[model samples]
Target: MVIKGLKHDAVAYNTMIGGFCRIGEVGKAEEFFREMGLSGVESSCVTFEHLISGYCQIGDVDSALLLYKDMCRKGLRPEGLTVDVVIRGLCGEKRVSEALEFLGVAMRNHEIAPKRKSYEFLIKGLCQEGRTEEALKLQAEMVGKGFEPNSEIYSAFIDANTKQGNDELAGMLKKEMAETQMPKKQE
Candidate 1:
């Protein structure tokens, strides 16, 4: 296209970057990302999201975080999936504290709210790290935001309640879990 005097736009760059990232060719994708800017195409949130996902997919959470900060510096509000993937990556790396901080900063302040799945990931991370109180608070906030806890969340709540000797809440969650899992009777 350069030979034909057609400059690559954001769409073309995004496609190439996403394609490379999907194929485990993040290096290639980064090359295209650099070329995109050199060609004067503005990088959008989708572009950063794809590259960040590629980094996270390859266990390069640090690079992904750097990219995330860069995106923020450029005034782009990352999409929900981007936040979710980053949280997953940080949690997977056993960096729950850092992930929590990121969630507080990026996800909390972003224009598009992170998905419930993102909250679930953070809750699981906090639970795994034995930070039950913080996890409970996060779960409470999640509930207040109109997000229903999933099975895993129920398990977390049950454990926390039991540890705190709050048998009432534990039993309630148990009953709720049972109710949710019960099959409906046919007429």
Candidate 2:
């Protein structure tokens, strides 16, 4: 296509790569990336983000991190969403510690603070790993950030404490559960 001048640009390659990744055709996506490299078409941050996210979706942390490092080496700093994908993927893979480490790396490397969803993922992962205290601490942090813990997060903490026979904690959580704010009826 470049030879014919029909579509010779990074956007075209990025779009094709994104399409292939979204359709779960990761191998083809990788092939396209390699082809872009061979064709002298530089990969954009979007392209790296897509490929790293695809690898993460497949639970391929090693590959994802390799891609992340390569992107850093190329001076292309990953955005918040890139970090979010890898963090969520790590949690899904039951690697909460690794996920936390990755979160730290993102903070240190990019100086980018995570959003609420990122904290949610880490809290849930911590709960799943039987670290309710850590989860609750994370919840406190979220609250400090002006984001109240959702019902699901509260429930997870309650469940975790209950399983460990921590009735006091459960009681506290139950007491603090979100109160329904019904609207007043008009006269």
Candidate 3:
């Protein structure tokens, strides 16, 4: 297209980047992204999103983080999906603490309103690491923000509490789950 002198806009650039990323050609995608910027095409959130997702998919979380920082430096406010991608990638890498910290900064700056899934992922990760107290605290914060934890998250908390000999807390969570009609934990 560039050879034909076709005018490429942000959407066209984003499409090319997304295509390359989909095929796991993140380097090419990044190349085109840079070209898009140099061509005076204004990069939108979608542009950054495609590249960020590509980096994350390739397990280059540091690159993804750097890209996120670049996006912020460009005054581009990240959307929920962007934040979710980074958070999920961090969690997948077992960097749950960093994910939580990033989320805190983003929320405090009013940059993004995290979806319930993000919290759930963090909660699950924390529970898996036996950080039950922190997980419970995060769940409480999620509830205070009007987001209901799902059955799996409740199950994790219950299991973690039970394993730690906090049977009373586990029972209380089970009762709350029942009241909310959440499915019972599988034996």
Candidate 4:
């Protein structure tokens, strides 16, 4: 599109960025964003979301967060989707503490409360890392925020505890699941 000079606009650049993200080509997406910058195309929140989501999908959370900070520094308000990607990346990397800290920032500074999946991912990651206490605390926080804990998250906690020889915590989680109507499988 840039080579052909068909029409350069934020929307067009965002569309291209979205396509690159879908294909897990975040590096290319970054290049496209730079091209958009050089071409005098002003970006929007959605533009940053697309690139951030792509980088997160590819396990490039550092890059995604860097882009996120850049968006903030440039005075572009981040949308919920951008926060979601950050949570996904942090949780996927087993960085639950960082994810939780960022979640707090999102809620306090940006008025973007995390979605249920965000909590789920954090809890799941903590559980996988054998941080049962942190996982339980996060689960409590999720429920306090009116978000229901999903079955998969509970199962991850249970399974992780079981694998770590923390039979007490595993049994406790199992009983909790039975009481809360969480699934027995799906771990």
Candidate 5:
């Protein structure tokens, strides 16, 4: 393609980066991402999205967070998948506070709406960390946005509230779970 007078543009670079990321070759993806910049091709949000996803895939949530910050610094508003990946990654690492902070910031400044799965991860992570109050608040927000809480979330709430001796809330959660006809997660 180079010999055919076609320089590697943003699209080509992004494709290569995305390919590497999908295959879990995040290091190579990063190399190409940097080289893409050195080659005078402005990286798009998709470029960052690919690399960030790669880092997340490899359990390098910190690295992904750095790239996400960089993307924000460059005035790029990440798409929904990118937001989901970052939130899921942070929650995977038990960094629920940071995930909540990121979500809060995005919603406050950019109105970024995460997918239901992202909310589920964040809510479950918070519950696991014994931050059930915050999790419940976040769950309310998610529900307010039209996301139906799944069985896992209801189970999480029931388990956490029961463990914490919040019997009223736990009983209410169980009743709600029954009303929804969602099966409870077996202990």
Candidate 6:
């Protein structure tokens, strides 16, 4: 298209890359991304996000992580979706600990706020992995971040604690759930 005098701006390049990625041609997407860089078109956060999502969709989370680090090094702040994609990919790989750690670092250092769903995925993965203590801690952190714990999350924790004979903690979670579900009085 540029050969025909169509200006190959970042948006045009990003569209081509995104199209290739959507069709499962991540290799071609990477090629176009590199070519875009060579053509002096600055890559946007959206460009990196497309490639990150493409790598994650293929279960190539390592590549996605590398791309994430590269994006960070380039000083392009990742959007919430970008962080969520990488976190979800990590959880899908059963690397829930890594996901949690990454999320913590991103939140503390980069100030990236995760979507509630990302926390839910990590918590579920942790519970499935029998890391109930860590899951409880994560749930507390999520609450501290102002995310309300949904029933599914509460139930998962309750189930885990109950099965482990931690009735006290399970009861506490139930009480907390009830409190969260209560409607607050308007000031």
Write the number of the candidate with greater TM-score, choosing between 1 and 3: 3
Best by TM-score: 2
Clashes of 3: 0
Clashes of 4: 0
> Lowest-lDDT window of 10 residues in candidate 6?
1-10
Model 3, position 138, has a per-residue lDDT of: 92
Model 2: lowest-lDDT 10 consecutive positions: 176-185
Task: Please list the residue runs of candidate 2 whose C-alpha ends up more than 4 Å from where it truly belongs after superposition.
Answer: 2-7, 178-187
Native RMSD of candidate 1 (Å): 3.0
Between candidates 1 and 4, the one scoring higher on lDDT is 1
User: Hey, what RMSD does candidate 6 come out at?
Assistant: 3.3
Candidate 2 lDDT, tens digit per residue, 69-104? 999899998999999988888888888999888888
Q: What is the lDDT of residue 23 in candidate 1?
A: 86
Write one digit per residue (lDDT tens) for candidate 5, span 1-187.
6899988999999999999999999989988888888989999899999989999999999899899889999999888888888899898888889898888887777788878988899989988889987888889999999998988899988888888899999999899888897566799
User: Which digits, one per residue and each the tens of the lDDT, describe model 4 over residues 11-51?
Assistant: 88999899999999888888989999898899898898898
lDDT of 3: 0.89
Which residue pairs clash in candidate 3? none
For model 6, residues 35-145, the per-residue Cα lDDT tens digits are: 999989999899999999999989999999999999999998888888898999999999998998998888887898888989899998998788987888888988998
Q: What is candidate 1's lDDT per residue for 1-187, written digit by digit as tens?
A: 7899988899999999999998889999999999989878899999999999999999999999999999999998888789889999998998989988887787567855757887888888787666888998998898898997889888877876787788998899999998986778999
Model 3: per-residue Cα lDDT at residue 33? 92
Best by lDDT: 6
TM-score of each: 0.84, 0.89, 0.85, 0.85, 0.88, 0.82
